[model samples]
Target: MKAAHAAWRGLEPVHGMIYFVPEARRRYAELGLSGRAGYFTSRSAAFGRASVELVVSTFYNFNPDLVRRALDGAWDVTTPQHVLDARYAAADEALRRAGLHELPALDEVVALTRRAAESACEHAQGRALFAAHAALPWPQEPVLRLWHAQTLLREFRGDGHVACLLSEGVGGLEALILHAATGEVPVDFLKASRAWPEVEWADAQQRLRERGLLDGDSLSADGVALRRHIEDRTDRLALPAYAALGDAGCERLAELASAFGRAVVRAGLLKPG
Candidate 1:
């Protein structure tokens, strides 16, 4: 189970960097998607003209208004296939620019990650976003295929995380507040990007404080325990996908994937933390 978490951390940038890289923004601009519209469209293109509500539900954070602004007429400007094509092209370019293609054991890590991703496909019954993405035809290039694999694993875990948050009665804004409390992500970044108003953010924080899960801006002891439980549950939920690899395979994948992820960071493909 620990290996599952470690593997996710290592490979996350493979999929996540696409959101920040200039290659992606350039492609989206060519498609007439301005600002963050490309992000919401490209990621949700697997749904093929998904409703704003559906995206808001599946994304499970981000202001509904923001999502609506980004997605309302996005499909009108471009087809899902076009958006998907651009997304893969951007991912390929970004990964190549990061020199991930030059990394040692590239093929081995792709095979390992794809195996885990395929294993995840078998459990896609209740995971909407993951299932939607899993339905797409696999990319032919090794680098894009690797990015696709990590994207699958990411959505697989994300859908499960949403389930965990739902079960805990945490609303979208509250979830962001909780995540911010951990200090792994900045409060301002989340608030600004998600487009949650300051008043709403404050109200959510007050709600969490009322529930004893927050003490001012940080997690209280009880809050820490709840966060821990949620994360542990999410990790456990993600374990079955990694199980197909066995402990040794998972560890090896993590080792190689982390190196690739680090290369991406060093190449400045991802934002500085």
Candidate 2:
């Protein structure tokens, strides 16, 4: 797991696997990496190839194996369900790879989507977000995926460190939350994640105050109330659409999404879907 350990330098809950797990004592000897022994149960998708995969959504693609492990983690078992859960997740992953499933096992946060939309409404006083791209050159992830995750342990982290930031934070993070009661500044993923000297937090705070977006150093009462309303409705219905997936099936979704995202990117969609 040296490579895996290196990958998730700043990320959390990193799981990895060695091709063979002949018990906890000799795995490191086989892999030839000297570290604490992170033995693989059948649950270690991070340990096995195809056992692990990417988890994806309309806006993001994640390691599916990661999701599988996450969900499985929700239920603690006294009877050792690791292998059974792994099998189930793998089956689900396989089915998804075949393009049969439409949604993720993870529930959708419609409130986030709606809030993003509302951010547009609040900031759409002059023009659209930007000139719509006539065509964007989409890029597919190489078939040989970067089977790695890392976390960056930096004290004063800043933009300009894409690999470190993503390794530590969300794969795609917009600095100016489209929904937050901040300034009208719209920092795209690139800008939010990459850093902009001009877009400091202090300036954003001032704009939020002057724009009547807040009152007495706080968001307007209406903004607070409306945000909660959206959250409540979305929470009530936000359950995993693919709760029935087996391990293989969930892996399938990750594999399919990886391929599809690449395809969509290559097709040069106006934007990353």
lDDT of 1 by residue, 84-169 (tens): 99999999998999998888789999999999999999999889999999999998899998999999999999999999999999
Q: Backbone clash tally for model 1?
A: 0
User: Scored by CA lDDT, what does every candidate get?
Assistant: 0.91, 0.28
Give the TM-score (vs. native) of candidate 1.
Answer: 0.98
Clashes of 2: 46
What are the per-residue Cα lDDT tens digits for candidate 2 across 198-260? 444446546555644456535676545544444343222211212223334334433433443
Task: Flag regions of model 2 displaced more than 4 Å.
Answer: 1-200, 240-273
Inter-residue clash pairs, candidate 1 = none
Span of 10 residues, lowest total lDDT, candidate 2: 147-156
